[model samples]
Target: MNEDPGRDVEQEEEELFEHYRFKVDPGQELVRIDKYLIDRLPNTSRNKIQSAARNGSVVVNGKSVKSNYKVKPKDEVAIVLPYPVREIELIPQNIPLDIIYEDDQLIVINKPADMVVHPGYGNYTGTLVNALVYHFDNLPERKSDYYGRPGLVHRLDKHTTGIMVVAKTEDALTNLAKQFYDRTTERRYHALVWGDVEEDMRIEGNLGRSFQNRKVMTVFPEGDHGKHAVTHVKVLKRFGLVTLVECKLETGRTHQIRTHLKWKGHPLFHDLEYGGDRIVRGTTHDKYKQFIHNCFELIPGQALHAKSLGFQHPKTHEWMQFDSELPQGFQELLNKWERYVTE
Candidate 1:
């Protein structure tokens, strides 16, 4: 749990909204919301449209309306929901991977920092998904319920290094997704954050994209915006100006730990997105500044690592857990801090 966590819970590459807005033509006839959407949104199923309306993800004039609601002439309609992925030509690349566990149903990889999980608009190649494609031919194919992403049911940030699981079959994909959706899977992270966090803390907040900056996520205390998120933090070590802490995710939200810790005034060390890149503590002397700068160079991104993951097997129903060694940069950075504190 890097102290200053940022971003929303739904920032996955495949979890983006398929947004549509329309003004009913003046001569249009009255039609059901689902029908109206189906006529306009190509390749969308009636069931998909109805499900969106049922979940209040579809709205008319800023108010959530049901599927049965009849559309009138000149009525404004807006739809914002996760749309099925459009199939794209996926090119496989023979990139190396750190495989920790592999079987017929699933494969666990200790993903390195700075690797994008899947390809998107700007990122087309050199991703974990590409490597998986080259390495495994029988990886589960995408269904209509989701956008075209192979094998992966969840994602990690481009800079977040940690353990991740990929499904090899459709059964494994569905089961893994359900486990994550039900919050039954266990995820633990290690983060080095600014400030001396002397004790354990639990935080609950509604997380959504920032109003000021759409690129980042923010917590909504009123619970009116975004989705509910929870995180538990326990202090593992204290180094006066910084602290090493362990985080247990109660809810998997994009940048939940980073944003929550930022809300608590302790952003992760060198986290560029959450204001951790600056010196938030310690003496302002030149020598101290140099030391901090050197530390920053050791770990260029946020000091966050997904240390452990636990979940039940899809076929066998047996519980499985895996732990990963910290990346070289993170370990060396911690050692430097330890030596500095002692000296």
Candidate 2:
């Protein structure tokens, strides 16, 4: 139940060499490592979970096991958690980042749908952190110790592409984070959801972790530990049961728009971890390796885009705004399948 503690709890950020230990609850038995840890490890993608499990970083019942290993109740789970780190030498390889705007205070990048912004349970490499590591000489390897995250002011869902601001400096990071935390940040997204939904509507609810699954969030009538989130939606396209909607946020919370839409009975397509798993089972051209492209046009991931971001420049002390168009794939899919709504 223990490993190296010298650097595990140290002030180091990018300790790609340090490992961690995870214990499994024997009460929750008979589940695959990747499947089980994917839910248990919040902020980590399933693909990375599989990779970690395969690499022997994940243990089951105190024994190294494959990602597909099944756990029995009372099995002590252990994980040699990888430290969040960039390769320490990777140059920012000109990966075609869509920069909307940049200033002394902060920078905005149009994050792709599949882009992971920071370090998490299974994601140890190839992320915005890696990119920033190469782009900026000193972007702060780890913003916090316990989480081992970056200075990302906010995050878009890995599958939900769009605009997000990155703070290159500590003061800017704190200011931007406070704006979001104080509910003063203005953000919006283009979301193509299943089912025709109302236009220009406000959704208010107390969001909390789902009792059914810790991996998902839900809207509840009664108060929970979750924060209050407010979202406004306006319809852009309609296809009988599904519709393209634009959402603006008054309060930024984890998966606020996505979780809220799903709670309202209109989950985004391709959101496997959420209620969107049903889309993969669709009849036509459905089913792909762990995903489905079901956008009225075309999307390899969910049809949510972080289109616009508005916030006061932390350093400049002036209001700044940025916007990003949909990625080519999302736009192309929208053009092609815009009418395929035979439903």
Candidate 3:
């Protein structure tokens, strides 16, 4: 597909929210939308549905409706709600933060490598959320206090280093969440991949968790499954066996950049989960193999960095952009490649 950096904002908005659509049966009796939805959506509460209705996320026949709106027979009903929060207790930990900018409404930070964004099954502490809760008091949560994630508008991979924005107030959280759902935020990543990508290109496909491997993501080109994703790539430099490229995300899906680049035959270097750990290109000579092995040791994981981010300020409505430098290991890896190519 031809590269179109701009994506359909409405489609992306639907993707961002947990969207549900239902058609009333011809013999169905009239019922309140909130009550109707709660019956159909398992583990959902009336309060959550009512909140969605107040936010203009509930609709009947393509028109926004209130929670009390009656669902009539033969009517098409749709609603978009924020994802449900996992009930996990948050424990604050005093982790040093690399603060880029901070205001009453929000904070921008440069996240380092090897830090998980939030607590999960295998990871329960030493996360960005833990650090955030310890450093910033009263950060707004998107859903309920049960939600361990506070002020997290977006996230990066555990091994990915980059810039991220966190909201500080409820108003700021709502506004910034809407901005992300509308696909107005700008995100750029720098990646070193294992191939000679000659020109700029766009990768379009559906991305979902692999059926065989739940921990990893895979691309579904047939469009039969998964969420739509798009990544625009521009070649920055080539070192014969590998190349450095900048990736701009049009649609953010889990592992979008890594999966898309892998589908294009250029997986990020040292990406163990996606088949980039071993040599995918270049000579198999013992000397060259040794050089590649040493290069892999330079970075903790994949050679990818979220170098830039841009969005409108939630409170001021003014556009703001932030950029971050590559980590020392990533830079040193590049230097080694440069020297190897010149020799």
- Cα error, candidate 2, residue 120 (Å): 2.2
TM per model? 0.75, 0.64, 0.80
- Per-residue lDDT tens digits of candidate 3, residues 49-98? 77667656677998889899988999999876554434568789989999
Task: List all candidate RMSDs to the true structure.
Answer: 8.1, 15.6, 6.6
* Local accuracy of candidate 1 as per-residue lDDT tens digits, 1-343: 1111233322643243345789988998888889889988877778767766754557798898989999988898987544343354677999899999988778899999888887766777888888888877544653334322456766788888999998775456555665676567899999999999968999899988899998788999999998889999999989899999999999887888899999999999999999999999998899999999999898768999999999999778999999999999999989999999999
Angstrom error at residue 41, model 2? 27
What does candidate 2's lDDT look like per residue over 1-343, in tens digits?
Answer: 2233322111111122223345656577577767877676545567555545654456665566877888676666655433333323433433456777765556688887676776444654566766765655444443331122335656666777888787654455545554665456677888777776865688899776678876667788566566677789898888655677889887766678888888788888656666664552334543432223344335556778888888877756788877778888777656644545542
Runs of candidate 2 with Cα error greater than 4 angstroms are: 1-96, 138-150, 279-297, 341-343
> What is the Cα-based lDDT of residue 314 in candidate 2?
70
Displacement of the residue 146 alpha carbon in candidate 3, Å: 14
Highest TM-score against the true fold, candidate: 3
User: Local error of candidate 1 at 175, Å?
Assistant: 0.8
Q: Could you tell me the lDDT of residue 187 within candidate 2?
A: 78
Which residue runs of candidate 3 sit more than 4 Å off their true CA positions? Answer: 1-16, 20-80, 138-149
Regions more than 4 Å wrong, model 1: 1-83, 138-149
Report residue 281 deviation for candidate 1 (angstroms).
Answer: 0.7
lDDT, candidate 2, at 335: 60
